[model samples]
Target: MYLPGPVYDVVSVDIGGQVLAPEQYRVDAAGRLVRVGGGCWPDCQDMAAASGEPDTFTVVYRVGLPVDQAAVAAVSELTCHLLKGCGGSGSCGCKANRNIVRYSRQGVDLEMPDPQIIYSQGRTGLSLVDLWLMTVNPHRLDSPSRVYSPDFRYPRVQQWP
Candidate 1:
C-alpha cells in the first residue's frame, strides 16, 4: 500500500479514511507492516470512542497546494482523508473512505463535503490544519489506532475517487 511519494490535495483525514505515503506506515521489529499515521484514513481505531464532546469532532489535513490555490487559501471545509481504527479496543471491521472525494483532488467541483462521521464518541466544530508544515500538535484518528499491516507493504491511495 506504500506510494513512492506524498499524496497531496487532502481535505479531511477521518477514521476509516484512505490514501497515505510510505513514511506514514508503521512496521514492527520483524519488519512487518503495522500501521499508517497522518492524513485521515478513518479506519484508525483510536478515534472511535468519545475523546471530546458527543456529536462533534475535529479533523486535520496535510495538503500539498501545488494547484487550486483558492481552496488552499480558504481552508474551511471537509476534504477526503481517513482514519484506520486506532481506538476501537480491537475491531478490524470498517472500510477506509474519502471524506469528500470530489473536493480532494484537481478538477472535480462541488461544495466541500462535510464528512458526517458520527463515531460512538460525538461531534463538534471541525478543525482543518496544514499538517505538512505544523508538527507540534498531533492527534489520532478514530480507527485502527493500532498499526499492524497483515501485508508487508505500507498504506497507499485506494484510487476510489
Candidate 2:
C-alpha cells in the first residue's frame, strides 16, 4: 500500500498483534509497501480494536527527507534570529521585528513588507527560513496527494481506530 513518505525506515509492522518479519514485505522506491511473500494483507479489520490487537493492522515508520547541510544552516539561522533578544540586559542591540510594517522618524520613512502577506504566501520573513521552505515545498502543499483506483483492492482501515 502507498505510505506517505520519503520513508526513512520501517520500525515495525503488526497484523492482529503479531509482528511481521522484514522478509514478508518490502518498501519500494515509490514508498509502496509491497508484500513479498505468498500471503496478502487482510481485506477487512476490526475498527473497534486498538492497533496491535487482534483483527487490526498497523505499520510504524519514520518519514522525511534526509537532513542535509542546507537544512541545518537554515534551522540555525532561524533559531539565532528567534533567540536574539530573548534573554539579556537592556543594552543588547539585537531585536526581532516581526510585525513592523512601517516606521517614520524626522521626515525619513522606512517600510517593511507586511508580515501577514508573507505568512499568507507560505513564507517566513526570515531569509534562510523562507528559502529553505521554498526549496522544500515550493507549492506549499499541506499534505501529500493521493489517487484511488476502483480496480485496485485497497486495504480497509478502520476510520475511528
Candidate 3:
C-alpha cells in the first residue's frame, strides 16, 4: 500500500490491542511501513493466515503538512477575487477576466492582480497569509515544520547497511 509521505514519525503500531516495538518495523525513505526482523506479518496466501488470530494490524502515523487558518483565508480570498467577475453565471467554464482594460475620456486604465505571479513565488496575494507564513514558516517550505528530538524515538527502515 502507498502511504502519503514526508511523515514526521510513526506514533505506534498495534495488532489486536498489542503494541509492537519500534524495532519490529521501519519506515523507508519512500515512506513505506515495512516489517523487519521476525515481525508478526507473514507472507501467506490466505488473509486469515497473514493476520494473526483475532486479526488487525494498525499503523498510526502523522499525515500531511500543517495548514494554518491564514493559508485557508488566503486561498479563500484569492478564490473570491478570481470568481468576482462571474456573477450568477453557472459553471460553464467561464472565468473572470485576468486583465480588465477600459478606456474613458480621462484616460485608459487596467485593473488586475496577478495571482499566478504570487503563487509562483510561494506567496498569496493576501497580506495576512503572507505575513503569517513568513512569521511561522520562513524559507517558504511547502512541507510542514519538522521538529526532531533525541528523546523521541522514530521507526525507520534502513534499505541499506
Q: Which candidate gets the maximum lDDT versus the true structure?
A: 2
Task: Between candidates 2 and 3, name the one with more favorable lDDT.
Answer: 2
Which lDDT tens digits does candidate 3 get at residues 1-161?
33576656788876765788887777676667777785546333334534433456666788655567877777676677558636566342236464544435557565545767867988765677678768777888778879989999776555311
Count of backbone collisions in candidate 3: 1
* Cα-based lDDT at residue 139, candidate 2: 89
Provide C-alpha RMSD values for all models, in order.
23.0, 7.9, 8.8
Note the clash tally of each candidate: 65, 0, 1
- The window of 10 residues in a row where model 1 has the poorest summed lDDT is 76-85
By summed lDDT, which 10 consecutive residues of candidate 3 come out lowest? Answer: 43-52
Candidate 1 residue-wise lDDT, 40-97, digit = tens: 3334344455534333333443423244544453353323222323445323223434
**TM-score for all predictions?**
0.14, 0.52, 0.38
Task: List candidate 1 segments past 4 Å from native.
Answer: 1-3, 7-71, 74-146, 149-157
lDDT of 2: 0.78
lDDT of 1 at 106: 78
Ranking by lDDT: 2, 3, 1
Q: Which candidate do you rate higher for TM-score, 2 or 3? A: 2
